[model samples]
Target chain A: MKTINLAESTVRDLNQALHDQAIECTEREWEVLEPKGQHNIACGLDQNISVDIKGPTGYFCAGMNKKAHITIHGNAGQGVAENMMSGSVRVKGNASQAAGATAHGGLLVIEGDAGARCGISMKGVDIVVKGSVGHMSCFMGQAGSLVVCGDAGDALGDSLYETHIYVKGEVKSLGADCIAKEMRDEHIEELSELLNRAGVDEDVTAFKRYGTARQLYNFKVDNTAAY
Target chain B: MCGIVGLYLKNKALENQLGELFEPMLIAMTDRGPDSAGFAIYGDEVPEGSIKLTLRHANEDYDWAGLAGKLKHELNVGVEWFNNSKVAIFKIATSDGIAEAFITENAPDVLILSAGQSIEILKEVGLPVNIAKTFNLKGMKGSHIIGHTRMATESAVTMEGSHPFSTGMDLCLVHNGSLSNHNRLRQELQREGIVFETENDSEVAAGYLTWRLKQGDTLNEALTNSLKDLDGFFTFTVGTRDGFAVMRDPIACKPAVMAETDDYVAMASEYQALTTLPGIENAKIWEPEAATIYVWERSSETGVK
Candidate 1:
């Protein structure tokens, strides 16, 4: 197993080096020894690879990734895993604002809290935050699954489409067109599977699911007030 | 109506061929502005530059040769006319302070667009297709770019009346909405000896902002000042030499979203205008704060646990 030392290099240098090597998959890991506030690390990798980042990362870390399993040991900044696709991204710590915003497909597992608009405009992805999520968690979500163990902020699932949101804690309030659906056996099963994938120790039977009532799918002249 | 689109590849080594990358995006939003277009693509190896001195003729009459010669002597760069008599873009040699000095003395209304190694702009008046071919934007290649289309409402529809105008130095601006305090600011800037060009609110905002930045405020600070001072419904994105900033008016009256990924961040007036090809996946998208300023550098550093 080779280790990639990023001690002396800037984030730009390390990112370029990784991209140039085309070293998609290996035991080789990049360690960020002393990072200040840096942004956009390990972005746009379309190959299947395993990367482990040691410390806290700045904004837009591991964004727009596909077919790569990236894990962050520390907290991630705004727009963490923005537009991830067809892969698994697990954050061992909390995530900043707009976590998993507009992700088309993939899985983002955040061990801690997520800031506002956590899944805003989520296209098709599954986000499992072990802790709480901030306000407007699922604004204009088209399709996805968000499982939160802690309470969700106001407008948790506003303007949602096909995405299924499951939260264990109290919901402050629901945004327009979002409501708490009955927690059925299938929902619990889905929650259980997601929890397993995220490696959460929490039991599967204790969560409630939320989603859109499908009142605002197509555009309506009468609904001009909503926009 | 002018539309400007800017893109940045988070870690990609973007260089040279900015016109190539910007061509498609400009073409996509041709309907926004149909008058005239121009651009400047910065690179890591490129020298630091100041602003673009945009001249908009009020009543469509002005002294061309005399002004050109005067600016050439003062700023040490020959003026290049980009549009008809309506527009001219000067590649001036000056610092932020000098640029401010020029604005304070002349009080010309400028539109600040995008800057930085990753940001480049392409804009035109009639059709994006014509501008693309004329500039050969389709054949170029770069990791990031921005484009603009113009439709004049408050402005003259002349070359200077389009989108993405600046002071021939550090700042570039593209606006999607109008400013409420434009006339008031215009009067204020005029009193400061900043020459007025067109009656465009975008220019007044740019001029006022450039002057503010020269006063030692960061771009965000200047933007904050504008937000507090300039009223009305608007959304604007500005690019500087190493950074880019986006802001909305007090009402958040216009639509602007930051669709970001590990690869890049896309901001546009409308979501559909941004999601044309969709290369990046699994990226999150969010909205900027109302009446707030958000800025980011060209690249970022990342790691995993």
Candidate 2:
């Protein structure tokens, strides 16, 4: 195992060391000590390595990842796993706003509650939150799956498209072009897989599904008032 | 964007180290707001019928003792003062209004930063580190502190435009977002006899709270009313005599994270400002919900437990 203490080294040093693995690929496991809530930790990594951050992180932790798996043991700041291509990011504690924002493909699991705008504008990513999510979760999401094992805040899944949203607890308010949909067998299967991948043990049947109503897919003159 | 950091020590044992712990928190947020920095510390209370005033002059070599001597001669009240950087802290055994009137008439160039029993505000247009060092912030002992670093979105980069604005006695506010209707609100508040020092939107917010408190509204109630009346994004941390309160606008675009332990309750715009705190690993950390008011006061029985 490789260890980098942030108290001694800067974030640039840590990212450079992690990025070096893309060419040589010698170290498969890494640990970061004293994360100290700094920004841009382990960002832009393309290697298939696992990095464990021992403390809370600042903005854009594990941002723009390709094939690396990152785990934050404490809370995460804004935009964790933003614009990721592939791989996984796990936040063991609560996350600030815009978790998994604009990520193309990856799996992001948040064990604690998340602030506003979780999974915003996501494309082809899968997110599972063990606790509640704040307002405007999954806003303008194009393609992804957001599974919440707990409650959801106001305006859930606003202007969504082709994204599956599963919430086990209460939803404060559904956003425009978003409504509760009937949970079919395929949705149940998909949610069960996401929950299992996120290591959340919950009954799949207890969840309700929400998605775009397909009315806003094309701008109709009748829908002008809603806009 | 601006950054706000506040620390309220619940344990009296940590009172002496308040500035030592809070100085780094403000310094860590330099990137967020590097235009200006300021803070309002609540400590060193004066006796009954006495108020402490924090005054600032552009000239660092201004004679603060001369001003105090003149104030004593005019107000007929014993006045004692000390200087910190370009600011001066004065303890006068008189009413806040009378002392302020005397200063405004006699020392026209002096800017009254704050006037209260326990609050002292110091602000300057500079980086947080330089401001901290110049003000000797590391040695300041206090029970609670509220600070701000400004990037100057709504107004100019002058010291008057900096945050931690005080519009009332022992009450101040630090904000992290812009208000859209401040110009209109300022006109309305001015008609109600609320005096504003600058065109900064944050000063208007502080004035609004002062107006509300004058209307017999509690801090929590005033904040709830602000959520409805004030437009635009805001994450405000307000410091009062007995306690402090935090509130964010309904949209909550501006971020605010709070952590509390047995010893203290700390808040900042991001987690980075709180990383240097002791026992933070075990603190109960959470993001304050949108449009919610969170208040912690130094109670008579158990203090800020």
Candidate 3:
């Protein structure tokens, strides 16, 4: 394992170390010290390595990540794990707005609450939040699953499509074309698998599923009011 | 994008260090907004029935002393003034309206930044670090402070366009996101006889709150009404005579985080702004809910109303 002190090293150095796939290199794990809530740390990584950030991070940390495992010990600013292609990013504390936004593939876990638009425009990412999510979480989600152990704010899953949402707590409101759906056995099993992978110990039966009603999928003139 | 930082000290021991503590927090968000920066400090309450107005002139050669003398002669009150470069602060033993009228009629080139017993607003079109140095923000002493760095999406980058907009006496507002309905709202406010300083959308928000507070609404009530009346993505941190308040729009597209310790309650656009505070590691940190008003007051007797 190699240790990189952000206090003494630039974000470029950290990215360089993470992108170094030389044959002579042996270290696969790295520790980021004194992050001090810097923005865009460990961003744009395309390696199957692990990065443990010691403290909080500012906006867009681990953004556009691919094939990397990133863990933040403290809070994260806006858009954490945004547009990620692959790999996992875990925030031990709370996350600000747009967490896991527009990600295609990967698993993003928040042990604490996530701010507004937690999974907005998500394509194919699996997001698990142990705490509450603010307004507009999972807005316009196209695919993948978002599981919340705590309450969800207003307009949950607004304009959602094909995404599966499981919440154990109360939902403030649902957005246009988003409605509560029945939890079938397959969904229950999938939620169980996701919970197990995220290392959360919540009962699958405690959760409720929500998704798009598919009424506005084709944009018929009869459904113009919903627009 | 913009950056905001606010600190409300619960413990009197930290009051003297308010500027020292807030400077770094403002500078931390340099990348978020670098066009301009501003802050409002609440300290040194004037004697009862008196007010302090911080004024700025575009002409550095403007005679602030002559203006102060004229105000004293015209208003028939005691006026003490301190001039710092293009900015002048006057402490007057008179009604704010009277002093404001006098300044408007006499020092037409001067712009009144703020008028209150405790609040002093200093802002300029420069980087956060340079603004801080120009205003000597590190030496200021206050009970609470609210600062902003602007990227200027809705308005031009000018001194008047910088934030911490003071629309009401001892009250100011700093906004992070743009408003969609500011033009219509500004017209509506204008019809109601509300005067605006700049074309910035944020000024309309400040004016709206000022109108509400003048209509006998409390801070929380005004902010609550804003959630319904204002249409946009916004994260607002308001500074009052006593303490401060924070709120986000319903959709909450913008980011905001708050941290509270026994000694203070701090809020910023990001968590890094609060990391330098004492005991932050043990502080209770959370994101304020969208459209929910979170307020803290200095006087224990005055709870959130």
**The best candidate in terms of lDDT:** 2
> Cα RMSDs of all predictions?
13.2, 2.1, 2.4
Candidate 3 residues lying further than 4 Å off, grouped into runs, are A22-25, A221-227, B300-305
DockQ of each: 0.03, 0.85, 0.77
Kindly report which residue stretches of model 1 are placed more than 4 angstroms away from their true locations once superposed: A1-227, B13-17, B31-40, B44-123, B140-144, B299-305
**Candidate 2 clashing pairs?**
none
Better of 1 and 3 by DockQ: 3
**Candidate 1 TM-score to native:** 0.49
On residues B132-240, what C-alpha lDDT tens digit does candidate 3 reach at each position?
Answer: 9998999989899999999999999999899999969999999999999999999999988899978999999999999999899988889999998899889999999
> Which of the CAPRI classes, incorrect, acceptable, medium or high, describes model 3?
medium
Query: Which residue runs does candidate 2 get wrong by more than 4 Å?
Result: A223-227, B300-305
lDDT of candidate 1 over B1-305, digit per residue (tens): 45566765564643444454456666655555666555434443223554444443443355556565666678666444343334334444543556435544764543323333233444445676876675566655555555567666776766566666563244677787777779988998888777666898888887887778767886767888887788776778776655467787754546565667766666754433454434532346455656667776654322100
Query: Relative to the true structure, how large is the alpha-carbon lDDT of every model?
Result: 0.67, 0.92, 0.91
Where is model 1 chain A poorest over a 10-residue stretch in terms of lDDT? Answer: A28-37
- What is model 2's native contact fraction? 0.87
Cα-based lDDT at residue A31, candidate 3: 94
Best DockQ among the predictions, by candidate number: 2
Quality class of the docking in candidate 2, CAPRI style: high
